[model samples]
Target: MSNPADPFVEELRAITGAAHVLTDDASTARYVGDWRRNYPGAARAVVRPASTEEVSRVVALCATWGVPVVPQGGNTGLVGGSTPDASSREVVLSLDRMTRVRRVDPLDNSMTLEAGCTVLAAQEAAAAAGRLFPLSLASEGSATVGGVVSTNAGGEQVLRYGNTRDLTLGIEVVLADGRVLDASGALRKDNTGYDLKQLFIGGEGTLGIVTAATFKLHARPDKVVTGWVAVRDPQAAVELLARLGDAVGERVTAFELIGREALAQVLAHGTPGMRDPLAGEHAWAVLFDVSETSALLDPTPAVEDALAGAMEQGLVLDAVLAASGQQAHALWALREHVPEAQRLDGPSIKHDISVAVSRIPEFIAEAGAALEGLLPGIRVVCFGHVGDGNLHYNQSRPPGMSDAAFRAREEAVHDVVHAITARMQGSISAEHGIGRLKQEAFLQYKQPVALELMARIKHALDPENTFNPGRVLPLPVATPRPSSL
Candidate 1:
C-alpha cells in the first residue's frame, strides 16, 4: 500500500490540497479501473488538480521524481488508455476536478471548456447558449473533454459534424517536464506552420496532458426526426445511408446500424419496458436521426421519401418513424443501451474496426463467416456507425463454453478478425485507439515506417517516457543516446 506520508504523495497533496490527493484503496478504486473492467490497475495516488497551472506543477514534480504519470479524465475509456497499469509506482493525474466552462461565444460558435467537463454537460451548455456541440457518444455522460480530444472520439454524429479532431478548434497541453502549451483559441483558419494541436488531439496522453480545449458548435436543431428501419442486410443499410445523404444532404446527423443479435441482448437485459421498435424479426436494422435548424422546414417528409425510394429498390424491409419527442428518445434508448446489455450478458471479445464505407457490407460478411468457421456457434453482436464505416464487431462464446476457456482463445479470435481487417485495408482500431489491448496487434499491423515515425515523435515530445507509457505504442521508446567525444 502507498503511504500518504510518503514524500512524493505529500508533495502531490501540497499541490492539489490533501483532500484532492486520493491514496486509500476505497477512494482510488474508481480511478484505477477501465470502464470495461478489462484492465484493472493500481495507482500510487490519484491527484485531482483544479487548474492548468496546478496540472503543470504536478507534472513537473513527477518528472523530477522520474515517476510515471497517467493522465486521466473520466476513466471511461474502452482500451485501458486512461487507467494506470498494475504497478502502483505511477501517479494518476485525474482531471475531473477541472470542470469549468470558461467561455461560450455565440458569434464564433465556439466554447472553451476545462479538461474535466463532461460531454453531456458541454452539450447542455451549448443548448443553453442556443447552439449545438455535435460530438455524441454512448458514454457522453461520463466521458470528459480531455478524454474525447485525446482519443479523437467518433460517435453517432460523425456523418454530419465529424470527429472530435474535426470539432476541436484549439487545445492547451501540459507537456513533459511541466511546460504549458496554450493553443486554445477560436481560430477557424491559421495558415502559419503545421497544426501542432493535431499531435495531442489523438495522442492518448502518450505525448502530453490536455488541460483545456475550444470546440466548434453548430446551430441547435429545431426539428429532429428519428427512425428505426429494418434493412435486408448490411449492404442494404449502407445503400440506404448513401441515398439518404444524397437526398437530404447533411441533415442526416446521426446513423447507427444494429444487428439482430445485439438488439436481442438489449431487449433481454436492458432497461425494463424496453421494447423493439419493429415487431417482426429482422437480421439487421438501422437507427438514424435527421435534424433541421429551421422549425418551418420538416425533415420528416424528406426522410419518408428516401425510405420510400429504398423500399422500391427492395432495400428496406420495414420501418418506423418517431411521431413525437418522447418516441425519439425511446428509439435512441435502444441504440444507447447496447453496451450495458452486453455487459449484463457475459464476457465477450470486442473489436472496434473500420473499413471503407463501400466495403462495410463485405467486411461484415467475411469477418462474421470467418469467426463462425473458426469457432462454431460463436454469437456475433456487430453494430456501429455504419455511416462512417466503423463497427463494434464482437464475439460471444459458444454455448456451454466456460468464460475462462473462451477468454483463453482471445488471441486467436483477434488474429482472425485483425487479419481480415488488414486484408480489407481497414484499421484494427477505428475510434477506440491502440491502447494496451491492441498494442501488440498495432505493432504487428502498422507500417514499419509509420512505427518508426511514431517512436521518433514520442522520443522527441516525451524523452523520459513520463506520460502514460505503454498505453498506445507497443513498447517504451528508448531515449536517444548522445555522441561522446
Candidate 2:
C-alpha cells in the first residue's frame, strides 16, 4: 500500500493546487497559533481552499483519511477556536482565499458572501448598495464573516442590531463527510422545519464548516448623534438606559459603559490627540448614540432633552454632547482603545461575563469586592456593552507582582468572579464563544442536562470529531487511581 502520509499530503495538494498547500514550518507556524498567543498548536500542513466545492473535497478527503481538520478564518478570534492542537495529526483549513461577494440584492436587503470576506468589507459592500450591515466590531478590519458567524460575535451595536446569529438568514456548510448542506436562501420568513442553519451559526466549526452565508441588512441611517455622560455607577447607567429606551426606543443604537480605571488606561496609552470626555474623575461613564434613517430628522435635540432630564434627576453627574462628527469618533476611540491599552499595560486576567441589566451594579460591586479581597491590590479593569449587561471585566497584576505569579492565580480569580456571576444567574462567556479557553468553565458552570444535550448534538453531527477537536466541549476527567498499598 502507498504511504498514508505521502498520499494524504499529495491528495490535499492535488485538490487545492500545490501553491495553496503550505507545508513549510514558516508558513504553517502562523496558522498553528491563536491571535492572543495563548494557545500554540502544531499542524502537518495549512490548506487554503477557494470555493465551497474545494472545501467539500478537502473535508471529504480528510474524513476518509481519518485526519482531523480545524477550519480557520481571519484568525482574529479572542478564543482559540480557529487554531490547531499540539498534535501534528491535524490540518488547518484556512478560508482566507474564499472571499467573494456572491449576491447583493438591494431590494431584498440581503447579501450573500463567501466565508473569507472581512467584516469591514461586508460593511462597505452594504454601504455601496445603500443599505446597512449593522454588525460592527473593533476587529472588523481583520475579523472575517465566517469567524464572526461561528462565534455569533457581539459588538458595541449588539443592543440594537443583535449578534451574528440574528443577522444571518441562511448558510452553506460543508459537513464532516464533505456533504454540501446548501441552505443559503434569501427568504426571511421560512417556517420550514428545523431551522438547521442555527446549528452551524455559532457552532465554532465544531459541527461543520460554514463555507458561505446570507446576511439580512437594514436601511442605512442618515444621521447619528453621539454623547458621553458620567454616571454615579452601574445603577445610574442602567437607569439612564431605561430612560433612553423608553423615550427613543430602537433609535438607541449603542450604549457603552467605561470605568474610571479603564478611561485612565485610555488616556495613558491612547494616541496623543485622545482626551477624556468628562472633566472630572467619575467612578463610571457611559457613551451613547442615537441614529435615524432620515437625514431631515435630527435626533440630537431629543437626545439632548433626555440628557437634560437625566441631569435634573441626578442620574447623570456630568456629560458632554459631541459637537461634530470628529468629536463623536474621538469619544468612541476612547472606548475602543481600552483593549489595546490594557495589552500595553501588561499581562492581565480577562473575563467576559454578563448579568441582568437590572442586576449589573450588584454584580460589579460584589465581584469587584470579592476579587480585591482574594488578591489585595489587584487592578480590576471593568467595562463593556452595559446596555446589554456584558462586561469585559479584566484584572491587571499589582505593581510588585510577577507575571508568572499572577497567571498562576488565574483559576482562583475566575472562580471568585464566575461564582458571583452564577449567583446573579449570569453567563460566564458572553460575546466570545466557548472555545478551548472556556471549555472547562462551560462544563463547570453549564447545567448538566444542557451540557449533555450539547455533547449529543456534537456527537450526532461529527461522530469522528473531524472538525475542531478539543474545542467548545471539555474533555472527560481521568479518575484517580486507587492506592496499591
Candidate 3:
C-alpha cells in the first residue's frame, strides 16, 4: 500500500480533477492537523470530492488497496477526529466541495442539506424559511453539518432544542466498503427496525462518511428574552436553572453557567462594547434565555417572573434582562466570546466533561478543589450548557509561566480533572468526540463491557478499518501504532 501506487493517484485525480487532489505540502497542510494543533500528521494525499458518487469512488479505490481513508468535514472539531495520522498510509477525504442546500420544506418542518454545508449556513436557510435550526455552537461559522452530526454536537440551545442527534431526522452515509446507504426520508415515526442511522450519528466518521442529512426544524420564536444573572456559587446556578425550567417549561431555551474567572477573561480581552452585566463582582454568573412561538403568549413575562423569584430566594444576586433583540444578542456575546478570550490569554488545557444535572454542582466543587490543590493559582475558566450539565472546564497557566512549563504539566492536570469526572460517573468527552486527544482517556474511563461492544460494532461495520481508522475507538491489540511513531 505504498502511496497507493501512482496509477491510483491518477485515478483519484481523474475522478475529482487535478486541482482537487492535493499532493503538495502547502495545499495539504491545513488538512493534516487537528483544530487544537496538538495533533499533526502527514497524509499520502488530500482528495476533495464534490459529489457523493465521487466520495464512493474514492472510498472504493482506497478499500481495494487496503489504504485507510479519513473523512473530513469542516475540520473545526476540538477532537482530532478529522485529522490524518503520521503514517501517510491514509488518504484525506474532504467534503468541503459538496456544500449545498438541497431542499427546505417549511410545511414538513424539515430541510435536506449536503454534509459540507456549514452550520451557520443551515441556520440562515432555516431563518429564510421562517423556522429555526437550533443546533448552534461557537464554531458554527466553520463547523460543517457532517462534522456536527458525527460528533453529535451539543451547544448553548441544547436545553430546549437538544443536540445534533435530536435535530437530525435522517442521514445519507457512504460505508467503508464504498456502498452508499440512502437512509434519508421525512418520516416522523419509523419504528421499522434497529434505526441504523443512529450508529453513524456519533460514530466520529469511523463507521462511514456522512454525505448529507435531513434535519427537523422548529417554529421560529417570535419573542426571545435573554438575561445575565450573577450567582454566588454553582449550587445557586443549578437552583436557578430548576426554578426557571419549572416556571417557563419549554420556553427556556438556553441556560449557561459562567464562572467569575471566565467572565473576567472575556471582559478583559474580548471584543469591544462588551460590558459586565452585573454591578458587583460575583463568583459565578448564569446566562439564561427564553423563547416562544409567535402565536403563543410572550415569553418575557415568564422570564421576568422567574428572575424575580430567583432574586427573592437569594439564588440570583443581580440580573439584567434584554429589552430588545439587539440587547439579547449583546447578552449572548459575553458567553460566546469566552473561548476566544481564553485563546488570546495563552495555551490552555481544556476538558469538555458532563455529569448528571443534579450532580453538576458537586462535580465542579470537587474537581475545581482537586485541580487547585494540584497546581496553585491555575486560572480556571469553567462555563458551558448548564441545562445539559456539560462544562467546558479549562485551565490557564499561572502568570509568568513559560509555555514549556505549562506543556510539561498537561498530563498531570488532565489526570486530576478526569479522575474527578470518573468518580462522579460523568463523561470525559461530552460534545467533542473521542479523537486522538482523548482516545487513551476514553479507554481508561469507559467500562470494559461498553468498550467491547463498541469494538464489536466497529469490526462488524469496518472489518478492514478503512474509514477514519484512528478516531473514536481505541485500536485493537493486533494493530500496530502508526509507523511515524
Candidate 4:
C-alpha cells in the first residue's frame, strides 16, 4: 500500500479506486518492464483508470502537482514507450480497466472502442457484427487499441487493409492538461481543418493519452488461401509479388519474407509440430495469403497459377500449398513463431527497418555484407512484410564472442543497418515507433526541420514535457563550453 500521508498517492487512489492504484512491487512489476526484458523501468504506482473521466481527473491531478506521466496500454510495446522511467516518481497511467466497446455502427462500418480493448477483442467484435477489422499483429492477443493507435502499428494485413492509422477514423484523447479531445465520431470525410487525430495516432503517448478510438471496418473475407514458397532471394520474393499483383492483385492480402535462419529457428525451437514449408533448406522463403470476401469466390486456383508462373520465372524454388485451413494456420504459425524462437535462442541486436519494395534485395545484401565485415560469422535473422517493405532484421552474436562483447556493439550494429537504410532511401523504423530505444537514432536520422516542427508541436501540446518524457525525441544538446552568461 502507498503511504497514506502522501497526498499525491491518496489523490491518485481517489481518482482511481485504491484497488486500481498498484504501489507494491509485485503488483507493478509487469507494468514497469517491456516484453523483451530489454528496457526495464520503475514507478511509484500503476494507476488503472476505468474511463475517460477518471483518466482526465488523474492527468489533471498529476499536471497540477507537476508530476510526469507515462501512459501505458497492454504493455506489449517493444521499444519501452509505455514503460515508466527508473525515476520511480512518474505515475503510470494504464488503460487495462477501460476495455469497453462503446458502440458498433455496422451500418457505417465503424466501431468505437475504449483504448484498453485488445486488438483480438476488437477483431472478434467486428466479426460478431459481420465485418472485418483488419489491423493485426503477433501480439494482438495482448496489445491494446490505445497502444496500437498511439504507435500507429502496422501488421500482417497492411498490404490489403492498411494499418491502424488507416483503419482509424476518429479518436478520443486525454490531453496532458486533462482536457478531453473528443473526435471520436465515425466521420469518413471531415475536411474542415487539420486532422488533429493524426498527431495522437503515432505520438507514442508523448502528446496525449488515447482514451478511445473509432476504426473503420471492411467486408469480412469468407475464404482465405494461404501458402508458403521457397524463394531464391528477396529479389525473387519481390518479383513474385509483382507476378501476384498482376494476377490476383485485389486478393493479395499478405506477403511475408522469411530468412533461412529465421525459419531454422522456428523449425528447431518453435512449436512442437513446426516443420519446414518445403523439403530443402532454401536460403529464403515467403508466406503469402490471398483472401476473398465473396462467399462464392475461391482464389485458390488463381493463386496456384500465379505460383506456377513464379516458379517458371525462377522466382520460386519450391512451393507448399496449404491444403486446408488447418494447414494454412500451421504455415502462418511458422512465420509468427520466429520472434519467440529467436528470443528462446539467445540475445540479439534487432532492427525494424524498411526500404522501397524495389530496393529490398539490395538493402538485404548490403546490410548483410556490412554486418559480416563488422563481425564475421555473425548469424543474421531477416524476415518481414515484403509487400510493404518492412523487414525485421536481427543479428546474433558470433560463434565465440561473449554476449557482453556483442552487446557492446549494439550501437555499431544499429549504425550499420540504419546507414544502409538511409542509403536506400528507407526508414529506420517501420512499424515500431521511436521510443527510448530509437531516440538517439531518430535524432541522427530525422531531418532537422521536421525534428524542429515536431519539437514545436510537443512544446505546444505538452509544454512542461510531462508526458512520457525521454521518448521519441531527445532533449536538446548543449555545448560543453563554459556559460558565457
TM-score of each: 0.97, 0.96, 0.96, 0.97
lDDT of each residue in 24-99, candidate 1, tens digit only: 8999999999888889889989999999999999999999999999999988888888888888989999999999
Clashes of each: 0, 0, 0, 0
Per-candidate local distance difference test: 0.92, 0.90, 0.89, 0.91
Instruction: Using TM-score as the measure, name the better of candidate 1 and candidate 3.
Output: 1
Best by lDDT: 1
The CA lDDT at 406 in model 2 is 95
- Worst lDDT run of 10 residues, candidate 3, spans 476-485
Q: What digit string (tens of lDDT, one per residue) describes model 2 on residues 1-485?
A: 85456778899999999999987788788788887899998887899999999999999999999998999999988878899888888899999998999999999999999999999999999999999999998999989989998989999998898989999999999999999999999998998689999999889989999989999999998888898999988899999998888878889999999998898888999999888777888999999988899877888777888888999989999989888899999999999999999998889888999999999999988988888898999998988998888999999997799999999999999899888998889999898988898887878989976776777778778888889988898543222233332
Residue 245 lDDT, candidate 4, scale 0-100: 85
Looking at model 2, residue 370 earns an lDDT score of 88
Best TM-score among the predictions, by candidate number: 1
Lowest summed lDDT across 10 adjacent residues in model 2 is found at 476-485
Q: What's the CA error at residue 5 for candidate 4, in Å?
A: 2.6
- Colliding pairs, model 4: none
